[model samples]
Target: MPLRPETARQVDALVADAQSAGHVPSLIIGVVRDGALAHLAAAGTQPLPDADLQYRIGSITKTMTAVLVMQERDAGRLALDDPLRRYLPEAAAAGPVTLRQLLGHAGGLQREPDGPWWERSEGVDLAALLAGFSVTKVAHPPHRVWHYSNLAYGLLGGALERVTGTPWAQLTQERILDPLGLHRTTYAATEPFARGYVLHPWHDTLREEPRTDSRAMAPAGQIWSTVTDLARWAAFLADPDPAVLNPTTVDEMCAPVILSDLDAWRGGYGLGIQLTRDGDRVHVGHGGSMPGYVATLAVHRPSRTGVVGFANSYGFRTGGIGPLGHQILTHVLDVEPVPTRPWQPAEAPPPADLAPLTGRWWWMGTSLDVSWDRATGELVGILRGDRVSRYAPEGPDRWRGVSGVENGEVLAVLRDEAGRPAALDVATFVFTRDPDSEP
Candidate 1:
């Protein structure tokens, strides 16, 4: 279904405002919910920005590289902790850095390759990239900090080639773009692509930016995409398909491994993905930039909703490109929130074993409730009425927490002299039938 007329107007207004403020040649924005594009709008064009028109996604390409890396991990080709030298034995300088460190941008490699800014200049091949690697090439020690290294991703692509004997671009097409049906995404600019430009600070004149093939650094930021394709990618990040990539693996990729914003902690880096705190909601996504293009893709996972925005100008003075997607998507959510469905009775009764554990128990003078989710057939543990954890029955008298505070913890059932259920040992905290019972 399309957005309401008033809501569409609001979205258009937001994009138009951003385009005017940023003074970009053109801008396009798209929003998705529940794996579907809910809204698509463009500003700065007379007719309208076509959803299929391509725009440089820049470092957003890193997200796809990360997914490909995760796919190799899921297939058991290598472990995340394996050192880079395990695959590329030639890089003695980057030998000690692990795949996990590179994925999380904590390997302390320099921010870019050893040439004249790979983003603006013609990219060198893997051999040239690796040949420059030396002990002094490292800016900081491994695992020192989240350094945002494009060079890391370039190395990842090279490592993948060694492991699979296939090129990075072809591997990506086979594993991701084709699987996801993202026909609009490609390694280079195609027809109907937006022309990138650098916005003049004082005047409104714009200078066209050169287009270069990032041969080796392509994994870092070298793809061209459209709002439509980006919206789909955003949805994939929010709710991934088990066929293309495991949802658990996606979760691992989104987990904050290091803080990029340091003390502020407003922004963090996961395994190639980026996490940002916007008010109470934390968004999982990545931002991209090259010489003349800026783009962003963000998803509010809880809502299964995401936003994508692109600007065809570099160094946007108004700073709209950074927050444009979030602002537009949040506004859409605010006006047209995802409708809630009424609760329905479970298909079957709670398991008989749940009877003994159901209802309220006392834990250090506080109440803990154990309930069964018939829909998922998992145990829902609520502490003091609010903190919730979901558990799966592990074995006899044992339940393992799958989420929340009890994650990875086991809840064991204690029995009395007569073999009657007595107390609960959750995360090593004793919960008893009586408030005053001693551990």
Candidate 2:
């Protein structure tokens, strides 16, 4: 379905605001809904008069890299938990940093090991870049905390190269871009790329910024794409085709792994995407920032709605893109905004038989609390430190929660030889009921 006129106006208003702010020379915005390009608009200016010029998408490239890694995993070529050293022996000394940790930004690595290479244009050999690892200290133990690190993704790029014996750029093209028919998207070195611009902080001049050669950090940030191309990418994310990424795998990528409360934006970090909540809606996507450009791409997966925005000026920071994207979504959906709320399980009143699930669950070495409300006849699982959530009875010994991070998921309690509830499986997390609780 096409976007309503009001939604179009909202997009135009945002572009106009950026233009009025005077730093943005050009912007291309696109919206995709239900597997189609619902709307696409280009305002301001591109160096040339053509509409096909490509802009550097920056860290958005990380999302693509992540998807490729997931593809490799799906093919049984790799595993998310596989140690980086499995592919690159040199990284063996870096300890037990796994590919999963890198995807989640939980692999204790520096934000940028060699510093700001884009601004200085200081190039380093691949070996020197890797050797700098010695100076790179882990901020926290693996998976304990989320520390955004460009170097970790750079390492992942190296790991992918070692595993596939191909460059990261080529891997992305072969695995993702080509399959999706994104003819206009490619690495920066590829032709027809837009020249990024940086507005002078003090002066009213726009200076052409040097294009970065992100070979070292290529996987972390180095891809050129157009609004049209990105819309297609967004569509895939909203409703993935198994040929691209298994729907289950895509859902896993969107699942929140680390919680964050920054500014007024409260959300979590998924594999390569940011999991954000706007009132009752949840969105998954990533933003991009390079020397002279800032871009945002986000999608409400359940609604099949996505918004893509790009600006030509760098150093222009506004509380990231989540808020603006959310506004756009709200306009499109024509829904009233509500306060953000954590996902909660449903409640069942007393007197129903609740003997099936009474015990414990474990995921990643953490135990989850499971109990049954005998009076209400409901099964509940507490995500360790998380608030209690009620599960709705599905069918004999099966139940499902309200589906907020774990939507469409079913939990089943396993029975022992004595027909006692001994283990419970809730989607991905598996829990073993306490032996003593077993009746």
Candidate 3:
């Protein structure tokens, strides 16, 4: 569905304000809902003739690289817990770093390679980059802390190459980009691409920044993408299609693996994805920055709503492209909020065995309610003023709590000698039909 006129205008004004206020050479913003573009707006002048101009997505590329790694895991090629030395035997510096640590930025590898600033200079090939690794690169012990490491991703790319017998870019293109129909998202800048620029701090002048290939470190941050394509990618992150990645794996990638901010959980690192919090809301996505380009993608997973934006100029220190993108999403949410659908009766009746289980029961004189969840086909148990758990059927008259405080505990319905319902025993905690009834 199309966005409301007022909402669209608000988004446009936000983008326009960001471009001028940030002194950005050019900027593009897009909002997506349920895998569809709801709004797209561009500000300032794009140097390219085509409207679909790609901007260097920087570390957002890491998210795609992480997806490739997960794909390998899903196909049984490797495991997340597998140590880096298992594949890249030469990476003795961080030999204990597992694939999970690398993905979640807990590998303790240095933030950059040993050579000159790789982003500003030519990048080395995989062989040369790996040759430069040393024990010093292991800034912290494996899994000690959350440290952003472009070098760690570079090593991961090498691992992917060894496992797939193909370049990381090729694997990503075939497995992720092509399958997701993100043709415009590429490792190299295609035609009609934005020319990155660095705005002067004092003077109102601009200088074009050099774009490096980033070669071996490309997996860390080298992809270029347009806002439209990124919006679709963000939508995919919110709602996996199963063709690119199974919904479960996608959820894993978005799960918080470590805290980026120790004081409070305002920021966190997922499997190759960045996590941010706004008030009580938590969002999943990634931010990118090359020399002169900056971009961000934020998705409200609950609503499957995403906002993506990119700018050509490398400006701002505190609230760069990230806040700009998040602001767009926040505004859209404020203007056009999503309403939760009201609960309704299910069409199918409860399973015959489960039918009698629904309703109020008493456990140790405390009231509990059992109800059937048709959505998941599990029996939900709510302990009054305590906890809630989902129970999955185990066998005849037996169920197992799959979640909550009673997780992994067994619940069995006991019957009298006449085969009539008598009592319930959940991990030895007896429950009766009547609160006043004795055990």
Candidate 4:
């Protein structure tokens, strides 16, 4: 469904305000719902003629690079826990930094190469970049802290090419971009692209920024995209195309692997994606900045609403691109609320075998409810402290925990000789109907 006229105006107003306040040369914003474009608006210092204009989406390219890595992992070509040294022995100096750590920016690699600024000057080839690797590249011990490293992603992109025998760009094009019909997103800027400009701090002047190809480091942030294509990509991240990536893998990409901010539980880093918490609302996406362009893509997963923002201002000190996207999304959610699905009875009642396990169990004098979910075909356990755990049937009279603290733990159902409920043994902890009863 299209956005209401009034709601659309409000969203446009937000974009216009951001452009004026941030001194952006050009700005474009789009919202997606149900995997379709809901609203799009643009503001520019010059009269805007086209909506398909591209902006360099900086590190946001890492998300796509990460997706390709996950795709390779899914195809059995590689594993997340595989050490970097396994693929490229040159990286042995970094020690046991796994693929997962590199993706999550916990690989302890330096943020950039020790050489002169690669983003400004044309970068060296992948082989030359890798040959210079030394233990000094290991900034912090592997997985000790979150260190944003463009070099790590560059290595990952090269590793992907080495493992697949296909260029990283081609792999991404075939596996992701083309599959999702994001033709507008490309490695180089196309016609009608916005000119990246650095907003002068003191004077009312603008300096054009060069679009340098980071060569091997291109995977870190290289693609040029428009809000239109990005809105589609955002939708893909939320509701993935199974042909490109498994929905489960996409979910893993959105889940936090390490904390980006230690003070507040506000931010974390996932495999390739970035996670943000705004009160109870959780957002998954990434932000990018090139010489003269800044871009952001954010999706409120629960609501299936997303916002994409692009501005042709190099590293502006205003409210930042992520927050702009967040504000637009929040405004859309507030004005155009997604109707909640009304509760309805299940087509069939709970299974007969699950009846005995339905009520309650006691463990260590605490009560836990073991309930069956017909929708998910799993047994859910609710502890007194409200820490809910989900378990799926593993075998006869046995269940395996699938999520929460009990994930991977086993729940063994003990039955009396007459086939009556007696006690449940979970990870050696016994739970019975009577708290005082012995195992």
TM-score of each: 0.94, 0.74, 0.91, 0.89
Ranking by TM-score: 1, 3, 4, 2
> What digit string (tens of lDDT, one per residue) describes model 3 on residues 27-81?
8888898788887888887462233788889989998999999989999999999
Evaluated with TM-score, which candidate comes out highest? 1
lDDT of 4 by residue, 229-329 (tens): 89899999889889889998898898888998999988999999999888778889999988888899999877789998788888655787778888888
Steric overlap count per candidate: 0, 7, 0, 1
| Candidate 1 residue pairs that clash | none
Question: How much is 437 displaced in model 3, in angstroms?
Answer: 5.9
Instruction: Go through the candidates in order and give each one's C-alpha lDDT.
Output: 0.87, 0.74, 0.86, 0.87
- Residue 151, model 4: lDDT of 91
- What residue pairs clash in candidate 2, if any at all? 345-390, 349-376, 350-375, 350-376, 351-375, 360-433, 361-431
Colliding residue pairs in candidate 4:
58-221
Which residue pairs clash in candidate 3?
A: none
Off by over 4 Å in 2: 46-51, 115-125, 189-192, 262-265, 317-322, 335-439
> Tens digits of per-residue lDDT for model 1 on 1-439?
4678998898889888888877767888887888888888787862246888888999999999999999999999989999998998767777589999999999988888886979999989999999957877677788887788898999999999999999999998999999999999999999888888887777788888898999999999999998889988999999998989999899999998889898888899899899998887788999999888899998998888888988888866686676888787677767887779898887776767677888788976888898898777688999988999999989998999999989999999999998877988998898998988776
> 295 in model 3: Cα distance from truth in Å?
0.7
Q: Lowest-lDDT window of 10 residues in candidate 1?
A: 41-50
What is the lDDT for 216 in model 1?
A: 90
For candidate 4, the TM-score is 0.89
Q: Which stretches of candidate 4 lie over 4 Å from their true place?
A: 1-7, 45-51, 114-116, 330-338, 362-366, 429-439
